[model samples]
Target: MKILNLFFIGLLVSISSLASAQSDAEIEKMIVELHKPTKKISDSIGKLMQETKSKIETEIDSVVKENLKLRSDTLFNAFDDNAINELKQDFVFAKKYPNSLAALKLLRRHVNRFIGMNFYDTYVEVFQNFSPEIRNSEKGKEMAQNLQYFKQSKVGSTAPSFSLVDSNGKTISIDDFKGKQYVLIDFWASWCGPCREELPYIKELYKKYHQQGFEIISVAKDDKQDLWKKAIEKEQIESWRHIFTSEDNKNIIKNYNVNGIPHKVLIDKNGIIIGKWKGSGENNKHDLQQLLKSIFEAE
Candidate 1:
């Protein structure tokens, strides 16, 4: 009897161990099922992110196309005198597409080009009122530079000093004539037609006022020394000192802020600039003559 009871006790112990092993395997399977759902959720999120990105790109492309079309239409309508007015009207449309990079680019281009066509003061006012970040952009830098250069080219500013070699290879500096009553600094080129046309009038003025302490300094922006000499001879501009500068000489040009040819600066004896003349129009000639006469009378 005792042997039979021991055998039964051992059999019961083995059965209990088998039941515990089965329970552990079932728990592991439950854990794996929970992890499977997590992986599915992760994959779903990734697919959704890709779809969202594609949608955003497609929308951006569509906005760009529309903005380009609008710009084209606006430019086409800008052929008339009412171009500025039309541009102002289209600015409302540009504002509507705020935050669109394509629209902002188009708006900036049109605004900058329009500013070039009008008063610089107005441009400055408008640009200053714009978004600060946008105004500091690369395009904005160029616009500001243009405005500054234009402002510096105005009359009554101190004429920039320069030194160049005369026809005899003697160095001449604008400061050399500082003690005189007045000085006329003329920028000319051998190939400039208007400069040649104005030579006779300049000669007349020099001959009349030269003895009265008036001096003329003609600076030639010429690449060829022979052509420059020939022009000086042909024009009979002998009373004035003639000097030539090389084609690559940018310092003088930048100092004067000269963008066009036939520019003249009138300076007082104290090295202070009094007036400026630009271009070769009839109005410019008349203005120059009047100014010279006024200066002579004042002296």
Candidate 2:
């Protein structure tokens, strides 16, 4: 049993590692080897395991084929204008196959794109189309929890509040900025490459807007305090308030729907969220900068 298990595990790993580079026939052969039935097991248990293994292999193959098709899809490649059509198709697939792992994987892969493009309502609809059993699965539970956080960080929702120790050892909360200044709650970490790349641009925004009742509260997700402080000093962004997430304070990440860094939430003086940006893409940077200009320049 041990040798058989190890042989199957090795085959699965080989399939995964070579799937992208393998020809369709070669990939199929590897998948077949991965799920091949063992002669050592009793007939009844072997039959059951074979059925389960066949189902899992089918799911994996379907997902892989769909992904390969997507790689060559020109319309989906264009993305900005044609993404909605593809997303609609994915939603249809999800609804039709409510319990399919392949369907769930497709949804999970595109969720960030959906959220980024302001199609959050459609994303929720897709989630609702899944079966109750699928919805209660572990992955489904995570998606459900994330949906609540997304609602809290929606553009019109009030910013979620939190208190954490700052670089100067002072306790700071989003509530402290309410009625006094517009705030940008930035979720980042010391080790994230994209987060490090955006720090200089953010520093300029802080410097430009600080006098105009603008403030930044950078929430570091670093597990190590020294790394957080070192990154701050290295980036020369010590002027803005800095804090880190800990086992005790990590709920701040969930409270803001921070699926990825560097996630940012912009709030007005009254604490109403004006914008929520994720990732370190050029478009995100431009949008945040343009909105800042509109607010402060108008005043």
Candidate 3:
């Protein structure tokens, strides 16, 4: 009886061990099946990422090519409905996709020409609408610089302050004239014919109004100091202040929007730009003369 009981217990132990081994094998097989689908999902994600990258590169290249065509001088100079339409489209693209590389590139490349062609307001509006990431980029910074004059030097805006060396090696600044006198800021070059022609009229105005709290600040764009001094002496009008736009000071030209020589800005005693003239002619002279007469002769 004892031998039979021991044999029965041994049989049951063997059966339990076999059952445990089979359960482990089944779990291993389930793990392998789960990993098969996971591997396929990972491979699909990698392929999708590569395709997305390639598509972005292609789009960037296409945009750059189109921009090159739009930047041509002929297209900008056409000044017709087609040119206007093209510009309008560019503006629309930039406004709608402010963060796009192509939009930023377009504004950076065409900002100067757009301002020159009298699209200043529109250019400014577009630039202001860009995202901070776009506006703070290197190209965006350059665009903002190009728009400086249009934004700061317009009529009814305060004149941008700057400093330059006078003939005596003395530094003079636009702020020096503020609150003390009404100032006429003249932008002239020694080689400019129109500037030379306007000298007599400027001198006459200075002589007539110098004692009445009026002052003239002549800013020369001369390449040579001797020529500038000679012109001053030959004209015998050195009674007023003279400033040379030296290499470091040439930015003043851009600040005042000196599109052409013989440009003049008239500022009141409080430093407000009261008048501006671009070129030398009877009409400009007449305008300046009348403005001065109205101010000093008002009393």
Two-way TM-score contest, 2 vs 3, winner: 2
Estimate, for each residue in 99-200, the C-alpha lDDT of model 1 and write its tens digit: 333333434454334223334455455556546555676766665676565555445555567777777778877788888668887889989998988888
* Ten residues in sequence with the least summed lDDT for candidate 1: 72-81
Instruction: Point out where model 1 deviates above 4 Å.
Output: 1-123
Q: What C-alpha lDDT do the candidate models reach, one value each?
A: 0.65, 0.75, 0.73
Q: Sum up the clashes in candidate 1.
A: 0
Q: Arrange candidates, best TM-score first.
A: 2, 3, 1
> Model 1 misses residue 25 by how many Å?
70
Give the least accurate 10-residue stretch of model 2, judged by summed lDDT: 34-43
Prediction 3 TM-score vs. true? 0.58
TM-score per prediction, in order, is: 0.57, 0.69, 0.58
**Predicted structure 2, TM vs. truth:** 0.69
* Residue lDDT tens for model 2, 1-299: 99999999999999875763354344335434532432122344445545544554465578765544334232222433344555566666566666654566567766664334476787798889888977898988877876777778788988888888888999998899888999998889999998998988998999999999999999988878989889999999989899888888888887887767888889999989998887766667888999999999999
Clashing pairs in 1: none
